[model samples]
Target chain A: MFSNRRSDDVAAPRAGRPRSETARRAILDAAADLALAETCVPTIDAVAARAGVSRTTIYKWWPSSAAVLAEALLDRFHESIEFDDALPVRQALTGQVDALVRLLRQTPAGALLRQLLAAAASDERVARALLAQWMDPRRESAAHHVARGVAQGDLRADVDVELVVDALFAPVYHRLVWGHAPLDADLATRVCDLVWPGIAATEP
Target chain B: MFSNRRSDDVAAPRAGRPRSETARRAILDAAADLALAETCVPTIDAVAARAGVSRTTIYKWWPSSAAVLAEALLDRFHESIEFDDALPVRQALTGQVDALVRLLRQTPAGALLRQLLAAAASDERVARALLAQWMDPRRESAAHHVARGVAQGDLRADVDVELVVDALFAPVYHRLVWGHAPLDADLATRVCDLVWPGIAATEP
Candidate 1:
């Protein structure tokens, strides 16, 4: 399950005008567009101009251009992949991996992620914002799912849930960043099939 | 078993003077030092000056600063790891992972790698050079080792060696890039232990 809490909740309360969802949506949309098109991080001014909002309004809501872009990316990730706790554990894990592979390979979000990663390399603020707002939460969600599987006897109770989480998911990111291999459609299944036996509870 | 082939062998042979290994060492050493000391890609001019070689000399040997850095990195990787074909498959794989984790965590190579990754994001040349010269070769070597394991019946015959390579090694890279988890001393053993069950040949 994804968190409903807004990434911009940290914005200070202001008296003059209530924060506008319409304006916020516009800004985030513009930021996402700019990030997809540009190799460099989109500037606040560029985003404000594209969104047809004042720079003051942009800054009032988000601390930096990277923050805006991170939120936009987080929004897309949430929209693209939703955990189904109802499914069997293996199916659930494979589905999440499949969804993530599709999102990375089939969407503008992948290019945007590469750009964010590039920015994060130089900008500590970008790295922190991304970790805090997106990567950490996403990883924690997956970790929690793994822990539940262990608790339910679907996976080995002795397994380290966090390490299993990394083993299952990190290949996607590795291929994404390194480009040494392809993020093909079958990758999700291949990864899950290989990793499942390692974590799955064994027969006596 | 490691290839002794020099990464810089692709350098075009010139009519005038033979390529000096001492000068090449200086250039690569300077490039590595600058990469560790700074966030951005070190410039050809800076490397030339630091190595006490002419800009023309640097160009004669490498197409770009990235090429120099790539060769420098490849040199370090080769220096750091030497595979032992005599060891059992599991120990061999674990040793490779352990060496990589140490290289990434315990040396300036970690910072240098982060810089290369960041630069590779925008620079197609860097990506190509890294893939062709380093990532591809290193991966092929590991894949060969895995294939040998399968042939020896130490691992499941049905295992995809390439995917196995990715699963075993990608976590280190994922953590390195994303900083999602610690690259602790035990990570190599932990990863190998978890993944080994999935790949190991089982009795009837």
Candidate 2:
């Protein structure tokens, strides 16, 4: 489940008004832009300046630049996943996997993820945000989908959804993060094939 | 094929004899140490300080810190791959796989590999050296073992060595890089089983 880190005190506020949504959007956009352009860790000052806002203003909502970027990227991912209601589970899963791969392969969001990971090696706050906001939820969603397949007897009940998601998806991400090789359609199919046999039910 | 960057240098005679092996060893050791203990990507100055030598001395041999670290780490990996005289192909291949997995799971070398990958994302020099010195050689050795399996009639000659290796081993590497899951013995065997069906001769 997603965390409600965003404040909910606006209902009975004694304040003049709620925070401007436009300002929040600008700060998030600026944070993502800095991360994309630098392909390295972005600083609070850099993001604030790019957004034409004060550092205090930027920090009021998001705890750090990584948090801002993570939320922004997650928002985009959520939007993409919203349109999968029309597809069958298998097709939906395949499309979702492909989208995740393409996102990591073709954009600054991928770079930001790696940058966050590198920073998380030394920064506890960055590490927590990465796990809570990105990896854990993504893992949960993939597990939910796989668990449904098991319920329907499309997949083996013994299949560990968590491990399957990692095995099925990590190679593309590994290549993306490590810059080892390209993750093409062939490679994606190889990944799905390697995992499908174990996931699929073989006998009654 | 390997890049010609390092090997293409002309063997020019100098007024004095070449750099001492002792100094070279010290420099290389220092480079690896600094990279592991301090910053993942240690500067030349840091390496020199660790070695108890001058930056000029390091610069006299290697062009960059990446080059220095690459040679050091590459030397360690080369020393790690053992070649037993009369081992069967399966035993040999499994030994090599186990050794590589052990290195990734249980050694400082694994951390160093991840460090190099982080640097590789931002530095092309580091990327090229890592591919040449580490990734390529390991892949070649893996293919060689598979080829031996085919010769011994344990494996189908028609199976693509590279794809089989990638299918069996890439998930392990992917797990290491992504930190999504730990690489365990059960997973390793599962990967081997998944790939072996396609690579081994069909049942009579």
Candidate 3:
């Protein structure tokens, strides 16, 4: 599930009427739309015009255009993938990885993510926004699930949770960025199967 | 070890004097220097000027500035890390990964690589150059090593060579680009240890 923490709420207290959920949704939607339609990150003015909100309104909510785009990306990811708690830890991990690989391969969000990553390399603001808005939240969710799996004896208690999370997910992004290999449908299953023996608890 | 295949040699046969090795080396060195010194990919003209070679000479040797930079990166990587054939498979892999982490963390090559990756995302030429000149060679080297391990009975014969290579190296690059965690001294050892159980041949 996505967090409800909006940048505007955390920036400073506002004396005006309660923040408009409608406006916030419109801004994010517009940002995502513009980012997908163009080769570059959408500008603040472009987003504001597309959303029919004043630039001041966008500025009030997000610190930068990259922040707005990051939120839009995070929103799309949340909509596309949901972790099923009822599944076994291994199955759940495989399913999550499979869904992510598919999202990156079969959607506009994939292109959007590539664009953000490219921009983040040069722009510190973009990098910070991506980390705070997108990568951190996703990593935290995975880490928590991994920790639970460890406690339940599905995974080894000695597992390094952060490294395990990286081992599970990093290859997907690596392929996505490097283009050295295919991000084929079975990649998730293959990756999980390869790392499973190292992370799984041994039978008594 | 780096391959000796030059892009110029593959493009077409040259009719004149043998290609100048001195010029080639100078061009690659200049390209690497400029890329590290600047935030953006240096232009062909800038590289030529820096190396004291004409634009035509650079063009004759490399199809694009990115190609030149890719070769430069490949050169630096070869200089920084060498795989010792005498070591056990696991130790060699661990050493290779650790050396790469150090190279990325402790050298200028790291910044140059980040710049190239950022540029590659937008420019098809850069992407192709990076894959052909840098990523493929690196992956090929790792693949050969893993295949050797399997042949030697040090690794599971059923292991996916490409995926195993990815597992060992991708996390380092992932952290490099994402900055989600530190590429510390022990990262390579930890990564190799985590994946070793899955990769190593089970004891009879």
Candidate 4:
């Protein structure tokens, strides 16, 4: 999940000073922008130019454009997910879906993630970094809530946790990747409705 | 969606003689290979060299590397789907899923489609061509069979056909793009099982 190495490598100062948060933010934003704008992964030099930082800064901090992108993604979108166990299973999952739908549709995050997806299809490093830094954490969190649904006796205990979670979110992603339709709360409600019955616990 | 223009452009040769089917096949195969092997969309010249065809042949027939990539996609993986209306709805839909699973898991089609997906994400032309030639046709065909399921009263009469079909196949694609699991028959079975109950009508 590249989580461990990222901390050590990114914070190490080649300039005998800690890396500037402002400069790092600028670089990550530029990298995400360039990738979306160009419809391809941005180069380190290109990101530096856009960020108004020297090429040395980018090289000193991040290993590759993908590395910057992964970090950029974390900065822009990570830690925004909330899983309230107090709520019923459907509302808990629906809350996550609504939040994600907003992140993707209402901000630059969607364009940026689409660009990352494009990059991941072709580049192994990008794919690995993205899976570890972005997707796995979110998927794990979603699975956590869904697993709780089973343990709470709300969802079918015999349900496949991964499959159930995937069912909940796959329709949204299907639209996102294919540009087939809008990612809306309505779609989320409909998916929850369709999937809930299949996974809901059956009483004897 | 992109169905109209693709027919006009790809078939018409700017040159006096019609484009050779043999040459087009080579070009397409080479372009798809380059995208997967090089881990990016191949250049026109690279495709020309790989295909052992003249650069002019490629230029005369196609607009860009993405165009060639799109055409390559259509040529490589089109016309493999089956959606029989005669069989029971479950079996018929399962057959399509089974065929797609095989194409994705057992052949170069999966690699080719993944490469096209990457190209489509970044390149608008690739995206249009992919949707028009590859995705739309398959979706429409699948819709045809699904509608039959509705008409035959196997599926719920009130079902939203688009949403139902999306539910059926989105998980397969989610796994494809994410590489979380193998594209196999068991996944197909689970998806159908989860989805069928939601979409299936109660027996009278």
Candidate 5:
């Protein structure tokens, strides 16, 4: 789960017994499962009931339901996204996009992302956690990969890496929130093909 | 406001004079204004008080605050977006993007959009109304314009009109919901430039 941001700093030899890794896993699993249900974002009490843990234990770790579900989503997303550098830059971009589309299609993780998006719209703490702990980490890594293309002269050295990253990722996020368009591997491929020539150094 | 969807079908020629357009406008304005305030979405009682209309009058029209806000947001959005076909394809796209960015930065309309996004995430009715009444019509128009470029051989005829439209619009929406990046003309121009060559039939 992604809520580990401050855990490293604060967790060094905590005053009490080390937090139960088993309890944490139970809480996360229950939270993830509950989020997929046809209901509003799962309540903390509901999560506790599902996990068979006290409300105190869940609250002790996560500040809110969005935080718990975000971490749960990251658990799945982390396993799915694997970078493949052997392919050409365009293919590499498309491959990464392929993995991302899968992560979003899951009922639980997808719903969690939507809930976090709404929460982030209004709540700064939720916003920072999602951006810093989840999106930015992946985005920064993607930027670095893009910078490799620029450095190798595969891309125009002047190509804005940040903008390219947005070009690659924003449509997925946009479709996730709006529900107006299809979110699929084919759409991702089209996005890559259209964007590739713009950034490529040589004439298409 | 937007809740007018089924009302026209249901609210058949109500007694006590016809529904007042003046009262409707006041209700919508008050609803939009209250949404911008740092408060919960305006309640029927609150809106009625703010608009100086009876709660019965509000119930006679809008189903919810989000409905009124959606209509108000559309009012400004419709006036603001004017496409100019005289310009070339790329320039025309940029022109439309410029107007959209302006409408979103306004206090009331911008906040209403954010609130509605949150509402849409949780409520299917709100999502359907937003897509049906607000976004789809505009998106369908934008796709038509992109199709023009393809038909005229200005852009590669193979380009996907829907994907191009998504490329043109999604970054702005991504910025709106996430608040992670700047949403401005400069960003819009950069998006157009990156996407143009890939879609364009001719060399830069």
Candidate 6:
């Protein structure tokens, strides 16, 4: 669903029939569903079969299965994460953590994330995409929100925003990859409580 | 090699011809070599073939390939990590970090770690083994050293041991998995400086 159907920077719109948005969505959905169901990654053939599209069509754009799945995951994240400034900084950070925990518990997206992490461990392209599109960008956005908290004197201005971001998010990643525990609301709350004081440190 | 090659438990009189320790060492060396190649994780079949051992010989003990590799990694570490109390706590912590960074830079060990991490992300068995054998053991060992420092008034009593361990370790891991940059002496010093103060914090 996230694969760009059309190329950017074209001189003008092509006269040919536009790509079918419905087909695109089906491909992504099928990829997500297949990822959750399978042991190893879902092959492009499996995705194409599930989506009722030719393998050629799937491969026409995405360079690899990881790329397709990465886009699908991004789509899921974009739909789920809503930035609301009205909530207090603490409230907002807490909510983001909760939301992230909840989303990770979803079998398909969680499995996909694990797959991408493994793929990224070895593949440079997947690594760059993950860092740029999902990991760092998300952290930067969270830091921006946390900066507002610092401005309001709700958090320590001296807090290393990047470190604070890592403190909050890296644990989730670490747990998901290593801890073998479900990232539930209780765990999220504990993390926030443990980290909030340090992150919100202020001059006496 | 650490696999059940005639239990050391049985009295020598009862045991049949003892397994050749040299052959065991050779098998481990070959496994590490193949893993460093990294096109695919070396399977028991491949390791056996490379080592000129029977498949039954490998499976007679290790339930999984990860088990074999895990033992090999541990064996490598055993040769390197000295478990004595001769070194001062602060010096030990610093030296241990340096040793770990150096170990991760090894061609075969590095590849094996990456493979194990990928395996850990997907397989619960691999994840548990890697944690028990490598990660948790080291952290626990490090925590004890840190506790001794606190007792001696060389570290902060309130410093969260787990947090300190994670902070000290995670950046090195992040570098290992993400960046190609060498973990230089300067970076090691910075890590010590950044972490030692917090751990050494007094009521100032």
On DockQ, the leading prediction is 3
DockQ comparison, 1 vs 3, better candidate: 3
Candidate 6 regions exceeding 4 Å error are A1-23, A37-40, A49-57, A79-81, A88-90, A121-123, A146-163, A180-185, A189-201, B1-26, B33-55, B78-95, B105-108, B120-125, B146-164, B174-204
**lDDT for every model?**
0.80, 0.67, 0.82, 0.75, 0.72, 0.65
Q: What is the DockQ of candidate 4?
A: 0.58
lDDT of 1 at A39: 41
lDDT of 1 by residue, B1-204 (tens): 555556436653554334466788799889877776773568999999999999998887777888788777777568445677788888878888888899888776766667777778888888887787667767877887899899999899999888899999999988888787889999999999989888999985
Sorted on DockQ, highest at the top, how do the candidates line up? 3, 1, 5, 4, 2, 6
TM-scores, chain A, per candidate: 0.87, 0.80, 0.90, 0.75, 0.80, 0.77
Model 1: CAPRI class: medium
TM-score, candidate number 4: 0.78
Residue ranges of candidate 1 with Cα displaced over 4 Å: A7-18, A37-40, B7-19, B36-40
Sorted into a CAPRI-style docking class, model 2 comes out as acceptable
Instruction: Write the number of the candidate with greater lDDT, choosing between 5 and 6.
Output: 5
Model 2 off-target regions past 4 Å?
A1-26, A33-42, A49-54, A79-89, B1-23, B33-57, B83-97, B147-164, B183-187, B193-201
Residue B110 deviation, candidate 4, in Å? Answer: 2.4
For model 1, what is the error of residue A50's alpha carbon versus the real structure, in angstroms, after optimal superposition? Answer: 3.3
Query: Per-residue lDDT for B113-204 in model 6, tens only?
Result: 76788888778878877776666656776777778788877887777676666655665665556442345555544455445645664656
Q: Over the stretch A1-204, how does candidate 4's per-residue lDDT look in tens digits?
A: 223443553455456344476787789889767765664567888899899999887876766788687777765565455566687878979777777787777766776677777778877877777776667667777888888988988888889888887888888887888776668657877888888878888885
- Model 4 chain A worst lDDT window (10 residues): A1-10
lDDT of 3 by residue, B95-194 (tens): 8788789888877766677778888888888889888877777776677778889999999999999899999999999999888999989999999988
Estimate candidate 5's RMSD in Å: 4.4
lDDT of 5 by residue, A1-204 (tens): 223543452234355444566677788778777776643468899889999999888777777877777766665466444465565666667777766776777445666778787888788878876775567756765776688788777889899887888898888888888898878757677778878888889855
For candidate 6, give the docking quality class from DockQ.
acceptable
Q: For the second chain of model 1, what is the TM-score against the true structure's chain B?
A: 0.87
Model 1 compared with the native: what TM-score? 0.91
